[model samples]
Target: MRLTSGVFMFLLLVLSSVCVAETYNMETQFIAPIKLPINLVPLVNEHLDSPFERYGCAASLRQSLEASFVRLSPTAEPSILVKPAESCLCGVHTCSFWILRQCGATYCFAGHLHAHSIEINQATLLNDYYGLTGLPGGATSSEATHFLFDGKSYVEEKIEPKQIK
Candidate 1:
């Protein structure tokens, strides 16, 4: 069967979305130790150019990463509230607020400032979650799920951490 270009594109998009495995709304408690350079503490909420700016963020992507966090997680599900905390890693330069998976890895999603859209790269996401020392990243569908749903199950509750602004 010969497929039209338009139809092919649609199929590809759908498949790409479907190809992403299903992650759980699972939760785990963590005690993330801060490891940031000095002077960047106050500017943790600033939109730095790159997340690796040695001193502080002077970039433009403040909200995109916020949206991506929701797309990344099942529980927090990346909304304005679930977005990366301003000063991550204890007021680091520009590291994102990540899911910190149980498998020991992370998913860093940073969108361009002003433009509130996310860019989810499969290779990058996979590498980060499965790579060596993937700093506090996850949300890719590799999480374990609950077999049955109960009213009082963990999924029915919310985990609200006292965030440091």
Candidate 2:
């Protein structure tokens, strides 16, 4: 049996919507000693910046941290979300969050963001990766930033204004 053109188009739209509707949410938990994959450790150390140079970079990072696992794509490996502990690692207003994803056999840095919270968009995508929204921290008038994966790393796409309710 052959399908009509209009039927084929409708099926295509349904499949595309199904793909877009798939999303993953990451839940962060505090981790002491900052346990991570051996291969990812170096990448994280190199990417993260610490204010305390005296303690050394790795030492400062290991001091206090939070982490979560997120799979941005269905067929891809899970990514790690590393956030600084509020007590030691956070800045005055916001803290940095690092995303590490598996690139081929080795894990690589996917993106870095500074915000109070990072949320994965449920129904938006770019380059086969999920979109993210970073909410600002503190009482400042700063706006949220939206990021989308460009096949390599997450880049800022737009500044989203705060919704007043």
Candidate 3:
């Protein structure tokens, strides 16, 4: 049977949306020594001109976390909190935030400045209770944006990190 383009598109969309794997929202604890990967790239907005530069911070953090996880256990699934902290900001230089991850339940930490890491009020889950998948928002191929999560999910949550300009 020949299906019209509009109908076919609608059906495909519905099926795809329905096929999304169900994720659990149950309260879970992080395994010991929650590791946060250190970002090796500069966090200046001007330096984010290329893909490598753009995703360097997040990708480096993920790679570091993965490496630590591999060393600890290749089979164990652990929850992680990736906190991006501003490390340096000068007159002309853009701000740079160092990324750190910890293993445990979410805890309140204060931001710092002057030769120290300032933890931002952002806690991103790395993996789930099961060793299956990482966080839902992966990097995208946008212009200069390194990481862009699902807009729909962010919209639903109504919480998007704002630039500290």
Candidate 4:
């Protein structure tokens, strides 16, 4: 009976490791402060409110992404692979992707500011970035919810990632 119990315990340990899901580090960048179009200025003025109001674009984006991530991944512990900096401007858009790769991230949450809106998208990191497709095991749509700032709060929208195949 003792030998049987030991075998069962060993099997449980091995199975538990296999069942554990991979944890991803979350990183967000505002890219830059948005310049709204003339027509949309009024609409955004009312809705681009953020908790880190005093912080600049980069911090604000990080805060917003962190908040949303917590809501989406209630059980997962939060981790930030990228160190906080006063700025996060990579000259070219593609340069930012290189930064993420260097940081050793399995996932990244990014927010970009546009003429009339703030867009948020999450992507997986592997050989390349994949949007909603090729997610790690056990990932769900909630974890990859594409959102847009609607002048009041983030609203779920279907925004496709550029690098997604």
Using lDDT as the measure, which candidate wins? 2
Tens-digit lDDT string for candidate 4 (1-165): 999999999999998876554322223433332222243222322333333322435534343122112112223333122222222322111111101111233433332221111111233222232221112223232233433333222334566666867
Winner on lDDT between 3 and 4 is: 4
Alpha-carbon local distance difference test for all models: 0.29, 0.68, 0.27, 0.30
TM-score of each: 0.21, 0.68, 0.17, 0.25
User: What pairs collide in candidate 2?
Assistant: none
Off by over 4 Å in 3: 1-76, 89-165
All-Cα superposition RMSD per candidate:
16.5, 8.0, 17.2, 15.5
Residue lDDT tens for model 2, 81-159:
7765443465666667888887778778899887767877756678777888877767873777788999999999964
Deviation from native of the Cα of residue 162 in model 2, angstroms = 12
Deviation from native of the Cα of residue 8 in model 4, angstroms: 1.5
Q: How well does candidate 4 score on lDDT at residue 144?
A: 38
The deviation in Å at residue 144 for candidate 1 is 20
Lowest lDDT block of 10, candidate 3: 109-118
